[model samples]
Target: MATTNVALQPKRGRPSLARASAIDRVILERARDMFFADGFDAVAMEQVAAAVGISKGTLYARHASKEALFTAVTLDMIAQHSTEAARFDHLLTDDIEQRLRHHARMMVNSLVQPDVRSFQRALSTVQHRFPDLAASISEVGYRYMVRIMRDDIIAAAARDDIPVRDAEGVALMIVSAIGGYQLYETSTGKLTHEELQAHAERTIDIAMAARSSW
Candidate 1:
């Protein structure tokens, strides 16, 4: 009888767990780029698999569907933005007004980034399909800013640096005002660096003025 050649046989089922996890990351990254570059409806699973140099079967094994992959991508993006926002803590100062100004400018600068805008556009494009995701995203983003502002306000009040009756309400108001300004900028036109700086300062000034009434 001829000797069997085991090595020549086809190699596999799924990859090793470690390898599979790595491939999953690559797939998500490539899928994210595609989704950002070409809108959700325009990107197909086949396109993503091709971009990752994987077979459609393999891609589907990792992510059951295109919507599932997009969900993963959205969560990844949110985690990344959260990490970046966390770094802003180091930029804060002992001066409450200056701290608020820094936060305003940093937040606006982050929103103006091309990749961030692309992600926002992606979300808006698919809002109807992912209403709950959209709501969660909005809540998380809004809550983070409000938390930071509220903490700063409470700290300042503790030190008698400012007079505020309701820290939480004040925080909400400030965040909303800045959010409105951001919306205006997005709808009208991009602001220059100087203009953004001025905008940040003006927002801080209004907040400072209103603290007495808060």
Candidate 2:
């Protein structure tokens, strides 16, 4: 019997951990867009796989199902927000109003974002089906926003810029006012960037003035 020469090939199965994570990042990016546009009840796993340019099997290897993918996408957003807040957490300047304006602008950016608006719509539509997930995101996102604002409030008051006694309450007022104003502006007619900035500045002024009584 003659031994035949055999070609050796790299075994193809699942990706390595790092590769899988990279692939999952892409999948979640696609999933976020799809879920934002179509909502949880409307988006299908197959659609996400195709959109992500991956096979259903490959996608499933990363996420067990659409719900799992959605959860991952939500978590990804949460992580990104946390990272951004941390990135600028130490930016305490002499201008408390200016800092508040900056925070207001960040809130405005989030509230006025088309993708965020779509995501909010999607969440509201499907929250009934995923009550726990809805509650989780709502609580987490709200607290994250509040925490960001509260930290800034405390910093500014410590610097004697705002003289806010109730840092936590003042932060809530400032954040909510900016967010609510943006939401209103977006729903009515979109405000120009300049107009929104002006509005935010005015709101920050009012919030700081209200702190005088505190």
Candidate 3:
């Protein structure tokens, strides 16, 4: 048998895997920026490819179409937002009221993020054409927030921080309040830091006042 030079053969290694991941991340981040800046219907894949200095073939190899690209971008945003939310470990403190206020403030803070506001602004524009996509985006956002709120509320109740009546229902209400504020602020216009903070504080304040009576 002919000698096989296996020792000299080039092997696929971790470098290629790292390079692939880096490329994917660059594509997603650049595409996400374009998608957020311009509505999904408005952005072209070719434009994203150009922006990222990649050929259409390379872009297509990563994402089939604009809609597919949008899905990837949206999923990445969701995951990132969850990661950001998870880092707020201070909210699990013994001070129940402070925790609730901090959560609301954090929600408000996210609402003002360039990515979050941009994504919400595109909802009305893209929803008619891609109803399912729009709905999925909204549903995923709501469910994530609700789950976080529910957990926090339960924790607060367990610590006797807040009255433990209907924790799930209260959590949903809190999420609705925050979500509603976010929607309004994004669609209407920019809310100054002062204004955003005031709204967040007031929202939690009112909700807490109600819980006191319940």
Candidate 4:
């Protein structure tokens, strides 16, 4: 019997899969830009489809609704932030305090960027309408920062670098301090690079002093 050469057959779905993924990315990038440029309520699904050069049916097939698309864009932003954070890992020093100061400075720098500020303002406008999604986003972003600080505290405690009875509590306080500073900066003018460094150092010092007494 003659055998069919299965290995020579062309793949059926690979090209479509690749094309679909590329289209999805384009949709997200365009949608994010539109949403940021004009707040969420102003950006329609049809607009996103037109921006991506796709049919409204195609956009709806992928995202179902504008709310769902915005959620995806927000999640993508968080994922990008996490990836950017990972890139600074090699720059961390052995000392926990210095490591934390570096992290604080990094957060301040990232948070104050024009693009980040625009996205944040856009999210803030719709937060009341989408409270559940807002809560979820806050939890994910806040917990990620707390977890990083908690791990550092635990490691430093193990090495007797710092005395702390509650690593999680200390981490929360540290993160909260950074957040408070960020809020102040948003209300006031943007901090200079030197001012940002000083704030980070001061926040870390206060946390260290509190931990030492524990």
TM-score list, all predictions: 0.78, 0.76, 0.78, 0.83
lDDT of 4: 0.77
Candidate 1 per-residue C-alpha lDDT over 1-214 given as tens digits, one digit per residue, 9 for 90 to 100: 1222233222478466666666777777788888898899999998887777678997898788887888888777777777776777777778878877767776776666677667877878898897777777776677777888889888988786656789888778777776766667766667555665677678778878877787
- For candidate 3, the lDDT comes to 0.73
Error at 89, model 2, angstroms:
5.2
lDDT string for model 4 (1-214, tens) is 1222233233555436656777777778888888999999999898788777767987899898888899889888878887877788898877888878877777766665666767877998999999877987787677778888888888888886656688898788877877777667765667565675677678888886776754
Candidate 3, position 115, lDDT:
73
Best of the candidates, TM-score: 4
Global lDDT of each model? 0.75, 0.70, 0.73, 0.77
How do all the candidates rank in terms of lDDT, highest first? 4, 1, 3, 2
Error of 3 at 120 (Å): 1.5
Candidate 2 worst ten-residue window by lDDT: 1-10
For lDDT, the strongest prediction is: 4
lDDT of 3 by residue, 108-145 (tens): 76776777777876666777788778777767777666
Clash pairs, model 4 backbone: none
Q: Which residue pairs of candidate 3 clash?
A: none
User: In terms of TM-score, which candidate is stronger, 2 or 3?
Assistant: 3
Q: Give the residue spans of candidate 3 off by over 4 A.
A: 1-15, 161-165, 212-214
lDDT of 3 at 53: 62
